[model samples]
Target chain A: MSGPDDMQGDMPEMTPDEILALDLALGALPREERRAAQLRLRSDPAFRALVEGFEADLSPLDATTDPVLPPRSVWEGILAETAPQPVRTAAPVSAPKPSLWNSLALWRGLGFAGTAAAAIALVTAAPQRQPLAPAEVATATPEAPPQMLAASLAGADGTPLLSATWDPLRGTVVITPAAKPEAEAAGTTPELWVIEGDKPPRSLGTIDISGPNAHAISSQRIAGLQPGSTLAISIEPMGGSPTGLPTGPVVATGKLSAI
Target chain B: MHGPVVRAPASPGAAELVQLLGRAADGDAAAFRDFYDRTSAKLFGIILRILPDRGEAEDVLQEVYVTIWRKAAEFDSTRASPVTWAATIARNRSIDRLRARASRPAAPLETAHDVADAAPMADALIDTMRGAASVHAALAALEPRQAAAIRSCYFEGLTYEALAEREGVPVGTLKSWVRRGILRMRAAMAEAGATA
Candidate 1:
């Protein structure tokens, strides 16, 4: 594939269709030209084929570029817009004011240092911490209106181990551990599971034990999350349960409740 | 000369991606998330090539994924590879943004000159090197000026007028260069496909 072809000087003229297809594929046409090409694309199958051929020819170049990891916010934004929205009652008569749960700054500040219990406490006390005037409340109804469900998992002795908040609208569950899991010290990892009734526990995947872990729930699993569903943490070998069923001892479990 | 490289089925994960997209079309959010995790970086890289600004690239990346989610059902595996289909969306969105903007920043024409060089592939895309190598080989077969013109227009998302102005050439001449480049590339790729 290397070495130049000898047909440079004898190159044939590109027909008008070829020129238009090339220009369209290259995205080099001006607005007016593009509109015309688009029209042809819709009405003319032959022209569209040429364009597709050009697109396929050019696409390999995309693979020649290095990959770049986009910031997490981009994925968050995508989930916000595309995640399935659960059926709910109409907006509250008095819309809820923006709270710490809605604040990115607060989340960033909490980072990994803040305990899950402390975060839950802050969420519970957020209204009092920053009391909004009636006018402010009326004006501050967040777009999409935050719908959050939180669960505070506790060890057998009733000691809070971790707290999780599920924002269905955002399709994410933020899990904050109060401290390093005992399993982490024992060469095993703590895995989160969602148990809904008689069905086997479904792994929500291994989560970061050291800090706040935000796991995006898939649409299928998001449906399983509700007020009564139980969230449990289990100790599993390094990666997580290999059999899809929890093989480790259940360390903590909690029931999700609407916040 | 090296034997012709097969173009389609560039990545081994192509079939898995097809399944993921099918699942996403069925409104499986988990499958969609899996798809996103696997493809976002590659799409982001494609978008960033055209829109150099990180903020702008990120915005396009978000837009691209949303489009992918919405249009997953429309994906025709017989027509294009999974990465190509997604990359086309990324490139088109980024180019649209580039055209809408008043000034081009970040990806200058000079930077696009390096496009023929082998780029480091993401771990998920390591299997695509054969396809990329064939494309590089095809581009390498063109006249330097024609190859450069095509690369600049593609990687920088430059319109004929913009690229012509930068190259200090007439728009018609620039179009001729690119059109000829496209034809030669198609021929070269066709030849490679046949040999493979």
Candidate 2:
């Protein structure tokens, strides 16, 4: 009624094409321009839902709440691994050259680096670094800041996932999942919480409960971490809960630091 | 944008295993001892596949190792090759900083690598692909131009501007083409039961 294209009198209609374009755009933009785009999309209810479904793709990352980097020593460990050839190794003018076995040791180190890279290649489709020798490591670009993890949601249960620690630094907690989630189908998503003391669970986020896969609970999922017993994930809604309490059943559970 | 909600079938032997990625991230003399014992040449194979900068690809190696150190916990043996999973993560990270916004008219296909991981969880992913193939077939049934636009948008990551450039049409018209194409494609994919 406010805009010229508004269906003030006649019901509006959208061709499938308009809906698709909007669906495509929905992947790039947010829901704010729905009014203007709605006209382009012809305000079709089914199309709108389709667009919503498309946007749902990025939810997995959203559910995670870690600072990309953890407080763990892994970052330091990585730095140490490629700690560099000192960048300026004193020009090595008069030092005695190392023997062939030393060279073999270096080759073995290189081989190890190579193997590690290969192992990573076999696991993730992501690129990994070549193995570094005992020397020749270089300093990383200081400007490339590590990713930051943050809390996203909370729930009725006493457990929550925590924020993520960026690359270069990572620590971990493992959880044993309950039997098949459908074993307790309440028609809600499994909620995750970071638990500490006797306090209510600090909601981290929720995990998908629709399937029968073992969900990995990472520290990068806390809503607002507090001192708690462990990180627990329960079920909740797509957008998550308005209340902090989790109304869903617990799926995977783990302690942040087994105390 | 929210990429896709479909849970990427769990990654097996993902980069999260400490025993797997310790040396790479550790960069320590002792750790690298273990690191090299695991994965290597495969990492190079994938990086070399896409990134032409051998030096740069090698540079990414360090980051990948560091990522492994910090993320080994996230890896699951049920997903895919540690290499493929790690490669995907590395590629995504590399492109994340280099990626252009959706509004850009030029689609960087040369720089883009298709999201193909090795064949471990290939079974799970293959199921999705079979499903996608059905959808693709359904898409094939649509008007050629219309389907082209949808394919360009969904799989190719093209903007409307780029679509127009590819088709040599006006932006507004291209916009219309994409919209219509998607509508038909969505219907087709859904009817085929390949959609999530």
Using all chains and alpha carbons, the TM-scores for the candidates as numbered come to: 0.56, 0.33
Q: Give the CA lDDT, 0 to 100, for residue A2 in model 2.
A: 22
Off by over 4 Å in 2: A1-259, B1-95, B100-124, B153-156, B194-196
State interface RMSD in Å for all models.
Answer: 14.6, 14.3
Worst 10 residues of 1 chain A by lDDT: A112-121
Chain B of candidate 1 vs. true chain B, TM:
0.85
Candidate 2 residues B114-168, lDDT tens each? 3333423312223334444555665576667766666554433344555577788
Docking class of 2: incorrect
Model 1 misplaced stretches (Cα beyond 4 Å): A1-13, A86-259, B1-6, B103-128
- Give the per-residue lDDT digits (tens) of candidate 1, residues A78-189: 8875766723357663554332222211111111111111111111111223777999888874444355778887542233557989988788889987544332445567
lDDT of 2: 0.38
